[model samples]
Target: MADASGLELVEQALGHRFSDRTLLEQGLTHASAEAGYSYERLEFLGDRVLGLVVAGLLLARFPDEDEGEIGRRFSALVQADTLSEIGGQLGLADHVRAASGVVNDSILADVVEALIAAIFEDAGMDVAAEFVRRHWELRIDAVTAPPQDPKTALQEWSQARARGLPSYHDIGREGPDHAPRFTVEVHVDGAEPVQATGASKRAAERDAAAIMLSMLDPESHG
Candidate 1:
């Protein structure tokens, strides 16, 4: 059993009290702990729960957006980086149980989802949804505009389609090292590859991604 006060600290962080203490423990237990019940299953369910709740939030917040624009924002909210940022805000790493007693961004992200599932299991969907809304709503508000950087926009679009991130290939570079121009191609599944050239590799990638985004929909990236 977990210490009484320890669980309370976590409860305070999560902003919800758990009736089933075991569920709370399971949510914090890493797979390496071999504790019979790890957070993996909870993480899986929490991922979906989060998506459903976040989708609702996006619809209410951005009713004027097309599916493509909304999907980019949705991808940002549910991505591992955002989840880990949320976990860090909740101070979740200090509460997790694992062999190393340390957690990475991926583990922290999974733990956030697991705790959402734990909340859903312990109380109900209302409380779980409230938790997501309370945290994620602020995130949406903080961003005055959804991401618009070309490469970032393209990557978000790819992830939104469940096609993973776009891959960038460097075709070639020319001119002197100090003034070399590079050509890059951006490729995503189910989409034709697009290429562009720029003063640097990163610039070329950005241009290629922009070209690809334009081909998909001239105004979809806004």
Candidate 2:
């Protein structure tokens, strides 16, 4: 059985009540918990749902912009960092169930996605889209221009200064085989090397490069 108070709190945060409370409970469940009951499948469906809604929202909001520009905005909007930030705002970490007794940003982000799937399953696409628009509109409206890819931006910054390209080294890997976490360090010519972790090597490298960029010019990147 699901905890009534906890479900109520999550429903309030999501602004959508679930008809099948089990769906919400399953969505909040982590793989680390019960073997057969995890949010992975819901997350898979939610990922596509989120992408479609966000893409539609971008198209409607920026009718004059070309595909490339809208694509950039779409990427930024659906990135794990953005989802995790929204999850934190909703206090999802407190509600998610994990065997380790700790929930990381990735888990929180996944839970948020799973919750979106739950809403879609319980109600319909319209309700799911409305929920997404309400929570994500402020973020979408705040952007004056499409953001650059962190990796490309870092490379451009280095090349403009006649500095050699950034180098990324894989420092470590952890977690289960199905969900490995990678640690990567980005080294610039003169500055201190910065490290970051992610669910994949590419993501870790990208995060490291972003950190390096922020360190070099806090005003521009930060």
Candidate 3:
């Protein structure tokens, strides 16, 4: 396959001049592309790479924070929304190769992970670790306290009331392949199942949990 146009700009943005540009190209191509390529495999490895680096960074930054507290912060930092936010900040939407030639938050997040794997493949984990730390450090610093992610909040709420663990299901999906919306349903023991939609399953599940929490405690909407 021919090189993606203006690959240097992407390199510039990543702060790493890839030795094997094909890896970078593959990272940018979405499954929807006719190029018969996608970032799925790379993203699998990239997800682990990102997790390892971020986990280490979190440990170093919060020496006094406990496991549960650091875990919540790690969850917040590594979520797809954070990845998409960083991707947008880096102007990655313009270069992503998708079916509609457009990149949404979900796709951008995948691309970001794929790019990390590509960097790892091109050079080594050290380089990829550096990339992750450089872009993600500020976000880490900004987490002054561990956040109560909706999933954690809902789980705690349910367990506190002897509801066992809340269940999540991917009840529906709609829209074009390039930009799909997932509808998730969260089931508590006694309450009606709550449904919510988002650009990705995790996000939809989070929203569903948040809705359930809000409904159960109207005053906690903040």
Highest-lDDT candidate: 3
In order, the Cα lDDT scores of the candidates are 0.85, 0.88, 0.90
Mind sharing the TM-score for model 3? 0.86
Candidate 2 residue lDDT tens string, 1-222: 557999999999999888999999999999888647989999998998899999999999999999999988998899888999999999989988887767887888899999999999999999999989988889999999999888888898988777889889989999865457999999878789999999778779888988889889863454
Assess candidate 2 and give its TM-score to the true structure: 0.87
Residue 41 displacement (Å), model 1: 0.5
Give RMSD (Å) of candidate 1 vs. truth.
10.6
- TM-score of each candidate structure, all chains considered together: 0.69, 0.87, 0.86
lDDT by residue for model 1 (59-167), tens = 8999898888888788879977689889999999888887766676667888999999999999999999999999999898888777666888788887887888999
Error of 1 at 159 (Å): 18
> Backbone clash tally for model 3?
0
What global local distance difference test value does model 3 have?
0.90
Best by the TM-score measure: 2
